[model samples]
Target: MVVAACAAALLAGLTGTAHAVDNLPPDQPLVEDLQSGGKPCATGDDTVYVPTPPRLSAVLYDPEEDNQPSESSPLSGEFEAWWTDADGTVQRRDYSTITLSSGSRQYWTMPSDLPADTVISWHVRANDGHATSPWSDDGNGSVCSFVYDDTNPEQPTISSPEYPTPDEVFWVDGVGVYGHFTVDSPSDDVVSYTYGFLGGPYGTVTAERPGAAVTIPYLPLTSGPKNLTVRAIDRSGRSSSQAQYDFNVKSGRAPVARWKLDDPAGSRSAAAETGTPARAGIGATFGGPAPTGTASTTTVALDGSGHGFLTPDTSATDIRDTFAVSAWVRPAETGRTMTVASQDAVGQPGFTLGLHAQESGALWSFAIGGARLSGGAPETGEWAHLLGLYDAETGKAHLYVNGHEVGDAVAATPAEAAGAFQIGRARGTTGYRDRWHGDVSDVQVHDRVVVPTEVSEHAWRKPTLLGHWSLSSATDGASPEQSGGTPLHLAGGASVYRASDDSCIPDIDPDCTYVPPPLVGDGHLALDGESGYASAEGPVVDTGDSFTIGVVVRLADSAPAHPMTVLSQAGEHTDAFKVRYDPPTNSWQLVMPERDEAGAPERVVSQITGADGGEGPGQRLVVVYDDGTDTIKLFLDGYTNADATASLPDGWHSSGALQIGRGTVGDGWGEYLHGDVDEVQAYAGALRDEDVLGLGGETNPCLC
Candidate 1:
């Protein structure tokens, strides 16, 4: 009965077939990261940049039992990740064990706060039986960069300010007159602004519109010439050129002066703000016993080892209707709360710009004022542009991280603050505490509400660059550079074979980085099927056992005289394994010869087609066999729809050579493919759906 069933199954065209294999220990499973194309390095990228989380995949089988999963040998997987430690050392962490799920084999990355530019290495191993496979290394674990692109967006353009336009000599009016310098961000991702006199400091404001206003606080008793300077800051932490407008301010103004902390070493005062500069008071000084704060290029790099601050000549600006303060901060670490800007008296009521973290949470809190309100949003160990603003007009206060509003409230700025106005440290009651850590720069203050749009624009991604493949060569051995830096190496004598005039196109997108077709083509290899075939040393298939094969082929016009052999390993015996195409049915099939429980040899055939019934010339086909899933799946031009059960048998390895294009059927090796085969890859195990689809040409991996 079993023999006839096998004969009937073989005769049924076996577009599909399945039975069962012997109950033996499973073989070493083939493993691979789940990606499209079911092929390793489908995107030809060894260094993958993961900004968030990443996933992996593998295939399992009992090779000795015809690729079947032994009931006693279920599949389990292992993973590991490593990165540079905070102490400038390397560290590796083992991931949790993963079991094979019936749905598909995959691995997920755990949430982590790996700092930018940290190199991470991860790999996986699979065991279906007593024998475990070594870590997968089809370049999947080559390297993983825990990256947050440091590429800042293009600097913005400040369009509105034709400062001191032609014959105009600007002047600061009383009662907090608004002198907005309308700006346009080149990236169009504006977030906020900091402006005052050309060299004045801490007159920053939130950007509401294209225009960023410079408020001249009215004191009812003051007068002098003050220069107004403005800089547009985009969401991605990019800042624009300073827009300066030298202007004079008459008396009747609330005391206000920008404390640009850009002075020389131990200058004892902030940078000169055109008209007036803040001075160091009694004991108020820039670091003395501690390493004195020094100019950091354009800003100040504050070391936690000291307490340093700037005491304005007078109150920088009186707290009023709309108040704002913004600065660029790069924290050295977390845990210790610190203030970047603050104003206080002996102790009544005060406000401070700072960051805090609840002891239990991993997130850093971007707090304005005090602990009463905060947001766990600011990223640590990196540069952040922070904005704290309150709008009397809207009756709201907001805190921005990298230009995006993280928290808001129906709040108001204090009507006043006494004592010495301070920068870099909170000053209240007894003395200076909560000193700033890390580097701080571009501190500015404004007397009006900053717009959210301005904050958002500041966080835009720098340039619009897509992944690119220069289809510009015709010779093999020459390397092709990818967008970010990976090079697509040519092998198997594959060369650029297309016309440069009109051939290149993003493998997937019509709008991505598309170049002219190369003299040859992008894919490293192009085969003509029958007369042309590529042979590699034995994958030495374990006959009658389970395995998987993946291939990316583009057919030309001709129809084959027999089945189109895509990948096969066969000899005269019944223990051969083959994945080929049946031209008449327009679908791919897997033929695995296995033995039944009674020790009888049988043929197991399964059919795999696409939703579109496969394709003809000019179309690509991706076919795969997975013993783990007991299924043969086919994808047409990247879309998967058809699949069938794979009934593998037990047997020893195939002694024949692993060949692409033609295979041995019966005594004669006649199933010859007759079209162009782009890529031929064999996985000793089943491949997840994405791996197959990726090689089939559906998704494009990231270039970051």
Candidate 2:
């Protein structure tokens, strides 16, 4: 049904060099006449020919712009192709006639089902009733081409967190969600990704190497639910079906509390008590309860006796036992003596669990028998959590509250005792004499030592209201209620709104509306201030690698260059370290004051800056530093636009405060960061360019 047409110019037996493959008919067209560039084929004489195209190459279905094929071949079509003596002119010829489409190039879309290893063939003929002549012998240009196969071809894959969860009580953990995508084909095809709620935000990630996968982290701030999707694409811009998932965001995880037994100058024993002291103390009423706009409140009425203790149950004391002691307390009045936990002997000197006045009354003293542990200098009317840990092996005792470590002390080994423990009073005499003057609740004691590292690994210590209280007129009016402590004050005129009776806006303020007193035992602090922006999230970082750290910062122009900083000890020892950017430059530079090859601190870091130029109120800046290569770069809105690098100092030491929003001991001091800093982080390694670009796309890594 196909027809071949050749012009009279074809009858010319002119020199072979004067004839072109385009002069051929439809049946024996030149390979150059075909639109498909890469394929293998044989000529009428059974001569093999390869196809090639300029500015492009054959590739596997999954082609990356950086990949190249090994074989070279021309495309296949019904006729042979050739160019006329004039530039920009081409012709095709067959056995009977020549067919040509001058000034028109061939274009074809490969079939999706094309075999991975198949090759195409093309034929050529002379338009002037002459057989196609050899290209090398004929001064005329012949079709040049190349071939391609599925070698090193990659499959369309998705990147994301292995497991994602939503809606919970707590959420601050290093368990991030990220994925790496790659290809196996070495085609010159370009690769990209499409992502969204239904798997959109297409063309977010691009492939540089055939099999190199790209990974990005995911963390949601809002405590809710959301869906996400992602897809892969090839050089031809063809996209694959999207991968999808449902993600839930919740208050991070619970803070972990570890306890160890430390002091006890001498052996201690428990006394037999009548009414269970552990259960008798002011009803367990100490903890952060939701809807209170604050941690729960407790009431304590000191009995005639000036002592209070939460005694342990009989058989509660055992050898090599690990225990945890927690109490929410508020001083009823200045210099008032109150014991939240204690143990006593009816007829002898034994271990006593309770707090006592320091020789100067400047701070409450934690003690067990003749041994004294460390305590904080709490305000006369402030609420606080006084926790204690006693480990016998390392003889290390620690205290923490709300995820921050307070101080440490050493103590003797704990032995088993057959007596009952007391609660809400210093355990001394027999009668209901020593009743505590403050409320105590959620008291738990495990039978083993809780390590400091273990506490760092868990999240529960982070406060979340899981309980409630019923306040009677007598209980609310007569007691130092929840309002008794140092009132939390916000700065910048930020007003604190009660999300509930126990919770408040987790944002910022204009003035001091929230003054979160140190909970003292835990080694961390949570903002008990007005919650702003309706979301609260923090960054997860690893400090082992060099890093540039930055926070979404607002500066007063007059502020110094480095407004905030974070420093970590190189290792177990307090030496060798790196410095990360805090704001503005938001770029990380290595400032290793101590570079000990024997113990050189491998620093890993991350930073941030304003996306929009500085002059505005809420611009964000990102800073980054690579310790391995000592490279420094800065980015606005996750784009690396600026960079600088320098040699690190030798013999650096990191045994200092990991200052936040301010420097530890230099240039930027007392300079409280102007803008709100959310999601601060440090990394253990260097981040790639694609990773940075990926963060800027509509598909945010932190999105749920």
Candidate 3:
């Protein structure tokens, strides 16, 4: 009988009519509805913004184990879930008694009584009649997690020292008033504030922590009544009620005519911040970097090619006695006299304020007809603040470079050469001589001679130096700061050596390549690849605000196995910012973390491939965070890399020591540099392109 049954089964299998039994267990359950709007409700970091009374859902999976059609078609199963509430109380729910079908979804609504700001961690598993599947997780062994926050942050309070109250008028001294606004919030969860002037687009300012006051710089475009509104935002992306602030801005002593030169490109006219506008002739181009503040976006570029000049209206020509002319200028060439601002006279200029080429170098000068007073060597292709003052009462013409007087005032009689007020060229025995060959911005003409204090104020727009290390020498295991009190202490056999000679005159030498050359200074600090670095007891720079950091580095290994940091500042869990060479991408990187916490996402901007001259020789690296533009710019060898620039509208403060030659990795220190480091500098404000160029050219940025 057994042999006959076996023969019958073999015949059935041969005929393709054998019965097959399903005996496999179900696959792991895939939770459904865990995401809202295509974004996962549970996140790896922080809470996800969601509606109240969150619902948990999942899709059950089962492998049919029975041969019967009815039992396998709609496979019955049960799901089990466990969760831990914010208060650390663990709870569970079992849907074993309730019937469920495979490949179908089920949901469990969270209790309405769950407290606000409650964080819930949960996991789910599926079980068939015979077997159970593994529990679902976030792939890293941790249970899925999310926060239940529905409360909004409290309203923010706004105040300003320049404009205290809405009911009163605040008198400002200049056309560009940098009004300082302080914003504070009562809620501890507030992380940032949104603010803007009435009828204007809003801007965001991130706070260092909860309840910490944030100071925002505002430049009023016009002088009149102004209204500003601010709203606090919490970590969960909830905004509070708005707070309104009102104030009036009035110029105390307005200029007779002030040409800001911020007009659109190709426009024939440059708008005046105070009075009549100036007309741009053929060769003048727009959109050059402004000399100072964010209020002035661009300056006019004069190539010294052909009839390039800016002529103001007749209002500026009325300055005959006790007049002052001041403008920020960056000279492209300095071998000959270049007139920045001048008024036409019969045979000569009424007054000329610009660079006068001397045997020693180009000197800042103020000249009247036959007399000229010149002092202080002004570098070519670098911005300089020039002011010419003619005080008729004193019968002297004063010249100032930067904010200080240069040479002794020269006695010169007044000349009534009230013709046309011209910028970029002056009239001499020859027609239109000494035309300017560079950028000009913020031209102002005052009817009365401005005092020394006012001249100082006009010339003082350079960034404040937080710390500067020339790295020329190391004494007693420390590198002394050139401009500040903080010093960097050397460690792990780091030592100083004379820097290599680089004979490249910027914008002059034909052989000079655009790539930054080797270190030009006296000496530089050398480090071993294994363990060598320098550190300071500081958060030397306020990373949360607009600031600049720069260094000249030459890597020992062109293709290192890992990233090599040139400079960094440690935060609580990571480096707030790092200027480093990353090997994987073979590029120089400017790295900043999205948050200060550990495992946070990083914002990396990179440029200049390692094989393309980023290694071997010393290269100038500069990073700038401009809060006004909401941008982080990376500069390689005095040249900006457009691809390596990004919009970082918010910043988190890093309150730790400034480190050189090493960066933070996880909970320990790593990314040590194997190279030479020199001319490390930190500034409290964003520096202009000309300023950065001056640094790379070995010019003192302070101009002291």
lDDT of each: 0.49, 0.36, 0.74
Distance from true position, residue 624, model 2, in Å?
Answer: 22
Predicted structure 3: lDDT: 0.74
Compose the digit string of candidate 3's lDDT tens values, residues 625-657.
865345688888877867878887566688889
- Alpha-carbon RMSD, candidate 1: 33.7
Residue-by-residue lDDT tens digits, candidate 1, 93-130: 76545566323465545445556545555555565544
- When summed lDDT is taken over every stretch of 10 residues in candidate 3, the lowest stretch is 30-39
Cα misplacement distance, residue 135 of candidate 2 (Å): 92
**What value of lDDT does candidate 2 attain over all alpha carbons?**
0.36
Taking all chains together, the TM-score of candidate 1 against the true structure is 0.35
The alpha-carbon lDDT assigned to residue 248 of candidate 3 equals 76
How many steric overlaps are in each model, in order? 73, 191, 1
- Top TM-score hit: 3
- For candidate 1, give the lDDT of residue 458: 34
